[model samples]
Target: MVYDEHESTARFLLPATGVTIDILPGSEIEVEVIYREIFEDGVYCKHGRNVADRMKDEAGAGGSKQVMNVKALLNVALGDRVCAAGVPFTLFPRHPGNSTLNPEERIRVQRGIVEPYFFEGARQYVVPMTTLSDVMEERGIERVDILKVDVEGAELMVLKGVQDVHWSRISQVVMEVPDIDEEIYTEGTIASVKRVLLITQLLKKHGFMVITEFDPNGKNHMVYARRI
Candidate 1:
């Protein structure tokens, strides 16, 4: 199953993935409203500004299994919020959901200076938010043999929401937790090494043997976990 809030890009890129990823109109973007913001394109650099475009141009490989596309923002908590492409004021996945964020880190994110690689954009839209556990229960999903997650920096939030699913159903997990997360490594926490331990520890707590030998992007480690 594939879950992405942006319908147009999701359908456009995963055309052959085989699922109904219809482009939801702007008004149909959310079921529950969160907050609203009108942003000015304050791009700091070209690299950061075009990050979203780059993702669209580079579609990931898909498996042969049947795919079900759901248009909703994946978060630990569910809500209706703005989720736009190239917009820095939102999609702060690096946020650890904790107060560990230093002043500098907080400032950068607040000013739309941290994500999309720190580039601000002009697009804006609301995204219906939901969690994996909620979706599983809603769909009556009982088992997931292999789970793969790569959400820039919201890896922990997604995993945390798995709850019973991770403990009972999922047999193996392959994910990429971006080590560049500013919130993942906080005060006195080393960014390079300790960041990975956080993921290893989480899986271990859930009765999984973990491995991280394949890190395609040196900054983001691809973690493999199997029920022991």
Candidate 2:
């Protein structure tokens, strides 16, 4: 498989190896929302601006859709608020839960300033699935409508950190998952197809049904699931 010279480009050029099967839209989200803008796009970047604009537009008049974006370094379109967190990571072989970064890895990730390579570090504080909930609760976030997790290969791990009680609070999930096998990674630590499937099953058990699967590029699959 060919790898994109740049991380941002890869997001659009990669070939999708997995399939996104659609199910049905579940319920409406009427709570606080969390958009984990994991990787920072860039300062002065319109990425976040555009998202915020669209969200506000959709929300319409009197819509109380507050968003919290957790960032790692890169800039993002500002939202209701922003929080700093290390990139979440775990040893390969695909675990069932999440892990934190060691001191060394934390330093590296904080300073790496690069793509897939930074993800290859020893440890990082990238927010974990549970952290999202923690931040929400800390901010008195009672209900959550949408969670857009696009954290490279750690998507599955992020989901693993969320529990049933927390799941009940979530309305819709938009996660970017790669076709495990086809994903072009220099580090070879990306979650495997088996792992991604396990995540899917976990979501299913939690009452989420896949509503749509589409290739954002040819490399990764953007999955949208809603509570049923």
Candidate 3:
């Protein structure tokens, strides 16, 4: 299930064994069985276990259990939060890491090129994710109305460093969660969907509502959020 907190309520998306439901009003609604099977083709066995076998095993050994596809489940929960908030937001691009480019180019650009381009737009300042916290501190930024974070595979790390900061002041966040692709960064590895869930949980805990998610063909998956 996905839940996002908005100004006064929450949005929800729930996916059951063979169905998916989108809830925008934070209230229950009756849905027919037909709507539940809209994307039956995408369903599959988990961990090599066929559906029947899994069900039989569960039935035999049942107490109360919650088995889920982490990625899909997280998406649903995030969707819920977004529906409640009723906010509009956009996703940001992925941040290219130093390992993605040649050492000389990375150094030259880090020290020489980025500054000019970062300041070219009004209310926009681009900097490496690793240095974001430092930049915020140096700039005396006590509040961030909107934040766009895309730090390649280092998104989790960047978020980790600022977990305890005053994130309530942040009205929006658009972050890219890296996927498996060495072409982008030598250090890149397959980021678990569970890790993404943790990040979303953190944001939700701080009163931010995920508003939307974008899965573009040639780019990293993005999660967009706004403050409750």
Put down candidate 1 lDDT per residue, 19-75, tens digits, no spaces.
454432332222111111111331111112222332344343343433444445443
**Candidate 2 residue-wise lDDT, 23-49, digit = tens:** 111101100011112223321122223
Model 2, position 120, has a per-residue lDDT of 44
TM match of model 1 to true structure: 0.47
Candidate 3 scores a C-alpha RMSD against the true structure in Å of: 17.7
Quote the positional error of residue 128 for candidate 3 in Å: 10
What candidate 2 gets wrong by more than 4 Å, as runs, is: 1-130, 181-193, 212-217
Residue 150 in model 3: lDDT? 49
Question: What's the distance in Å from true for residue 90, model 3?
Answer: 28
Q: State the RMSD for candidate 2.
A: 15.9
lDDT of 1 at 48: 20
Candidate 2 worst ten-residue window by lDDT: 26-35
